[model samples]
Target: MKPNGWIIYNGNLPGNKFLDYAEMIQESATKQGIDMKILKNNALLSLLATDQLGIVQLDKAELPDFVVFADKDIYLARQLELLGITVFNSSKAIEISDDKIASYQYMATHNIPMPKTIVAPKIFTTGNIDHKLVEKAIEQLGLPLIIKEAFGSFGEQVYLLHSLEEIITKIDAIQGKPYLFQQFIPSSYGKDLRLQVVGNQVVAAMERVNINDFRANVTSGGAMSVYTPTKEEAALAVAATKAINADFAGVDLLIGPDDKRLVCEINSNAHIRNLLDCTGINAADYIMEHILGVLS
Candidate 1:
C-alpha cells in the first residue's frame, strides 16, 4: 500500500513561494506512486484538531504518516510531534535555526568555525546607549562588524557597522531587542554561498552575489548563480545542518580572506526556488522522498 503523506502549508493560499513548493511536492509524490495531500490551512489550528489528521479537507484530524512543514510554523510543528506524528526538520531544529545568535553559538561550540560573535544583553526600555559594550565589541572584533537581530530573515535586519559611530546609532535605534555583533568577513564581497542539505546530504549549492548591495538574500535583490562547492565546503554545510539536527535546511557560508569557510546561518524552512533555478535540481522531490521514507 502507498503511504499517505500530508504537507502543511500556510493558509494564505496560492501565490506564496511556500505553497508553490507544496504543489511541487504533490506532483513529485504522484509520480512516485504515493498518495500525497496538500492542505492549505492555518497550520497552528490544523494541528489542534485530532480528527483532521488524514482527512484532506476541512475539520478532520487523524495521525498522518508524515507531515512536511513548508512554513516556519514552529509552534504547530511541536504540537504535531506531541501527537506522535513524524515531522520533517523537527520543531527543536526549527527553533535553533530561527535564532541567529543560537545558530552561531551552536556552530561555534561544535567547532564549525563561525565568525566571532558577542550577544548583547536583552533590552527592556530604551535609554542611554551601551557605549562601553559597543566599544568593547569593536575593539575585539574590529571595524566593519555585522549586527543582526536575533530573529531575522531575508537579510531584513542585518547591518554592516563600518565604524563605532554607526554601531552606537543603530544600537540606540534598535533598543529592546537582543543583537549579535560579529566580525565582518570581507571576502564575501557581497556574495555568499547557500547550500541546500537534505537528510544529512548536500543536494545543491549556489553562490548568491549582491553587486549593488551588501546583503546576499535573493529577496534583497541579489543575483544567484550556480557554484560547485568543493568537497570541504559540501562537508561543512552538511555538518552544520546535522549539528542543528535539521532534516532539511539551507546553510549559508561566508568565505573569508584566507579562503577559510565560516558557517554563517541555517534556514530550517529553506526557500528552494533560487536553488532550483541555479542547480536545476528538484528539491521538492527530494523532500517528498524523505517524508515518504520516514512514513514507510
Candidate 2:
C-alpha cells in the first residue's frame, strides 16, 4: 500500500512562510502518487499519560505512516516518533540544528572545519555582563569578530563586533540567552554558499552575495545565483550535515583565509523557496523522493 503522510508546520508563526514549506512538500508528494495532508502542529496536542503516550487532535484520526516535520517543534516530533511514526530529519537532529551552540559542538566533535569559536558562559539573569569572559573571547577570536546567538535564524541575532560598545550593546541585549563568539572571515565578508543535501548527495547549490551588509542571508538583502560546488565544498557540506545526524539539511559554507571551505551553519528545516527560485530546482521533490525511497 502507498503510505499516507502528513506535513506538519508551525501555526504560531505570523507569516505564510511556514505554511508555504508544507504546501511545497504536499505538492511534491502528490505528483509522485503519494497521499499527503498538511496539518498545523498547533492543531494537535502532544500529551503523556501514566500508561499511554500519543498525540491528540480535536478531529483526530489515525496516525500517519510518516510525518514531514517542517517546524522546530521537537517535542511534537519526538512524540510522534514515540508512537511509531517516522519524522523526517528526526527529533535529535532537529534539537541540535535548532540551537547554534549545539550544532557547533557536534560539528567540532566530528572535525568539521569552521571559524575559531568561543562559547559564552551561561548567564541566567540580565544587567550583569561578564567582562572577563567577553574579553577572553575577544583576545582569542580578535577584534572585529562575529557574535552569534545560539538560538536564532535569518541572521537576525548575529552581529559583527568592531568596538567595545557594539559588543557590549549586543551582549547586554541578548543577556541570559545562549550565544557564542567566533572569528570573522573577511574573505567571505558578504557571501557564502548554501548547499541543499539529501541523503548522501547535494541536490542543489547557490552562492549568496550582499553588497550592503556583512550578512549574506537572502532575508538580509543578499542576492543569490545558481552555483556549482567543488568536490571539497560538497564533501564538507555533506559531512557537516551527517555530523549533526540530519537526514537532509541546508549547509552554509564560507571561504576561509586559507581559501579552504569552512562550515558557517546548518539549517534542518531550511526553506526551499529560495533555492527553487535561484536554481529552478525544487528541493521538495528531492526530499519527497528520498523519503519515499527510504520507506520503500
RMSD of each: 3.0, 1.0
Which regions of candidate 2 fall more than 4 Å away from where they truly are? none
Deviation of model 2 at 139, angstroms:
1.0
Steric clash pairs (candidate 2)? none
- Best model number under TM-score: 2
Highest-lDDT candidate: 2
Residue 62 Cα positional deviation in candidate 1, in Å, after optimal superposition:
3.7
lDDT of each: 0.82, 0.93
For candidate 2, the 10 contiguous residues with the lowest summed lDDT are 124-133
Per-residue CA lDDT of model 2 for 104-140, tens digit only, reads: 9999999999999999888777458878777888889
Residue ranges of candidate 1 with Cα displaced over 4 Å: 12-15, 41-58
Whole-model alpha-carbon lDDT for candidate 2: 0.93
TM-score of 2: 0.98
Clash count, one per candidate: 6, 0
